[model samples]
Target: MLSEVYPFQETAEAARRVQLNDHLGELGVLCLAPSPGLGVTDATLRSRIGEDRITSLMAA
Candidate 1:
């Protein structure tokens, strides 16, 4: 896995960079590389899969 000094913070920053592109079009700051290491959390999966042990989602 790739790592960076900053991860999600920079990933979100990269999104903002896209926003910046609109103004920097002539300045040519395209293709800003978002740092690797954007990660998934257990909470992230829990949102989709349902975390309750009593009535959790089941697969057929």
Candidate 2:
């Protein structure tokens, strides 16, 4: 189930890590965007369109 919502802090931490690595690129920093192996279907995303927050986030 996708009931477990990930908090914003986790996303912030990931961004912070990426920025840190990018800033220290002289140390041979490398980044790879591999598939997450899990994703919400288009139907599921469409279903969330009515939700104001979800819609706003999607728009952003």
Candidate that would win on TM-score: 2
Q: lDDT, candidate 1, residue 30? A: 21
Candidate 2 lDDT for residue 1? 21
In model 2, residue pairs whose N, Cα or C atoms come closer than 3 Å (at least 3 residues apart or on different chains), thus clashing, are none
TM-score to true structure, per model: 0.22, 0.26
lDDT of 1 at 43: 78
What is the alpha-carbon lDDT for the whole of candidate 1? 0.37
Top candidate by lDDT: 1
lDDT of 1 by residue, 24-52 (tens): 32221123324222233467665776655
Tens digits of per-residue lDDT, candidate 2, 1-60, equal: 211222343555545656776433222111221223233446776577644434211100
